[model samples]
Target: MLEIFPVYITPFEQERLIRVYLPKNYNKENKRYPVLYMHDGQNVFRDNDAIGGKSLELENYLDEIGLEVIVVGIDQNSEDRKNEYCPWVSGEYSKKILGYTSSEGGKGTEYIDFIVNELKPFIDNKYLTLKDRTAMAGISLGGLISTFAACRYPHIFTRVAAVSSAFYRNQEELEKLLKSSDLSSIEDFYLDCGTKEASGEALISKEFVASNNSIYEILREKISNVKFEIINDAEHNYFFFRERFPKILSFLVSAK
Candidate 1:
């Protein structure tokens, strides 16, 4: 079942919608399950509430498979999305991607702070959760922040998934950080990008795929259990993310 409620985000000093997914048998058994925190709350569940009327429909997938886990979908502030999703200011490549200079970034640390320090504790206390078996997942810019969270607090997030990640936004800084950070605490990581992500048309963007590949190369050395894939014919949208959600979710929950 899915439950929706408004919660105050202390770091942003704003109230946001949080979508929680409880297992079908949550009330029937005394089982404590792992927790998976996801970004883009609106697009993580039902389609009616999603942006552009498209979503991952994660509730259906989880319920169909009978996966017993708690999913917390944190809503995004549309106006401050870029700022909250990027850990640093727009890099050169990011500027080029938009065909102009943009300075909407650098608040990602605060957003993550709220999740790690405030949100996680609240979820743990309110639900019967396996506190140690926590994971995170996101898409596009959301993917960028999930990766940053894993590196910043490796001990807190044991598994992570980034699909169609716009790592180019902070590629240079992230690559440097990944090379130096200790990722030994991350037990499983699933990273993937589509060949048709740039324009979402027939034309393929080698540059986009290369940006994700570079991060994968760095992670393979730092993380012992990392998986990377270049999905064929996929684009940067909820439709494609939904198609690949099963694989990503499977990888994360498999080991845990």
Candidate 2:
């Protein structure tokens, strides 16, 4: 059986959903499993909330396959999502397209702190978890946040799975940070993007391809335990993410 917990984050007064999937043979007396903190909580488990029934269907599939682990889904506040996702904003994308005020920036760091310091402790205290082995996963803007957290707090998150990361201007900044930081002991990292036109508004455009390639190239050079996959015909949407969740989960759990 799965356990669903609705947690309220104090910083933004946000109610996030935490979905916990227990293995069919889960025995509290026998084993402890790793935890995966995923972004866009509303779209991760079921289609009932935001995606209009186009959710990833991850919980159902993982439960059916009996891959037991705790999945915490952090839902984003749509209005402040871009500010919370993008680490660094350049040009007018933040204001013109994303609709963010100039003063309401740098929330990504706070979001990360809330996760690593606040939410993790709360969950660890309440559930059976392997604290030392933790991972963060997300798609699109959420993917950008995951990568930023992994890079900034390498010690906190041992694994990062970013699907179709929205590099934008932050991509270059992350590359520079990774180049300057000591990443020898960092944990596993996974990145995947699709080539289809429908994958994402940014991915389908030719301009963003260079940014994505640059980010991948830099990670390849600096991070040792990393995997990069470019899906030829896939697009940026919940459907594609659903298809890829099993593979991502398999890789993440294998490290445990």
Candidate 3:
């Protein structure tokens, strides 16, 4: 069953809906489960709520695998997604990607603070969770934010999966932030995308292949375990993430 509730993101002063996907018999079961916090809640489940796309079908995936874990999906505010997902940088990138000017986006650190301080404490107190077994993940721009979250609160989130991250948009600034972060406590990272993500006819605002590769290299240099890959036929869409969700979950849950 999915538990839904309204959460106030104090930093943004906005109330976002968060959905929790609990395992079968959660109320009857006595076991505590590891938690996976995901961004873009609308697309995480419920096909009807998907923003012009299909749902990830996450509930079915979990049932088929028989892996009982808690998934907390945090919905994003559309108006501030760009601003909040953009990594906290020193404003080096010219506020532009594919000719579109990005907002100052320096507020991402504050956004992460909201999740770490406000949302996480609430979830931990309300649910039966394995305190240390936690991960944060996202796709595209949300992916960018997840990467930042893992770094900003390495002690809070031990694992991270940033799929097809829009790193190319704020490459320079984001790299600076990653390089300066303390990743000593982070357990693992799954960073990947498709080579075609950078192609001409692929319809992406910016090709993020090289940027993600750079993120992998930078992370590997500082952190011991970092998994990077370029899927053969993947794209910048939910289908790629949905197809790869099983492997992603396995890696993340194993880290616990």
The candidate scoring highest on lDDT is: 1
For candidate 1, write residues 1-256 as lDDT tens digits: 9989888988888999999999999999998989999999999989999999999998998899988789999998999999999999988887656668888899999999999998899999989999999999999998899999999999989899988899989988998889989999999999999888975544336677888899899988988899999988787877888998987888888753
Compared with the true structure, what per-residue lDDT tens digits does model 3 show for residues 41-143? 9899777888877878887778667777899998878877777777654243434445455445667788788877898889889999988888998998878
Give TM per candidate.
Answer: 0.96, 0.86, 0.91
Q: lDDT of each structure? A: 0.90, 0.74, 0.80
- Residue 29 error for model 1, in Å? 0.8
lDDT order, best first, reads 1, 3, 2
Candidates 2 and 3: which is better by lDDT?
Answer: 3
- Tell me, by TM-score, which candidate is best: 1
Off by over 4 Å in 1: 200-204
Question: Candidate 3 has which clashing residue pairs, if any?
Answer: none
Off by more than 4 A, model 3 = 88-97, 202-207
Model 3: ten consecutive residues of lowest lDDT: 88-97
| Preferred candidate (TM-score higher): 2 or 3 | 3
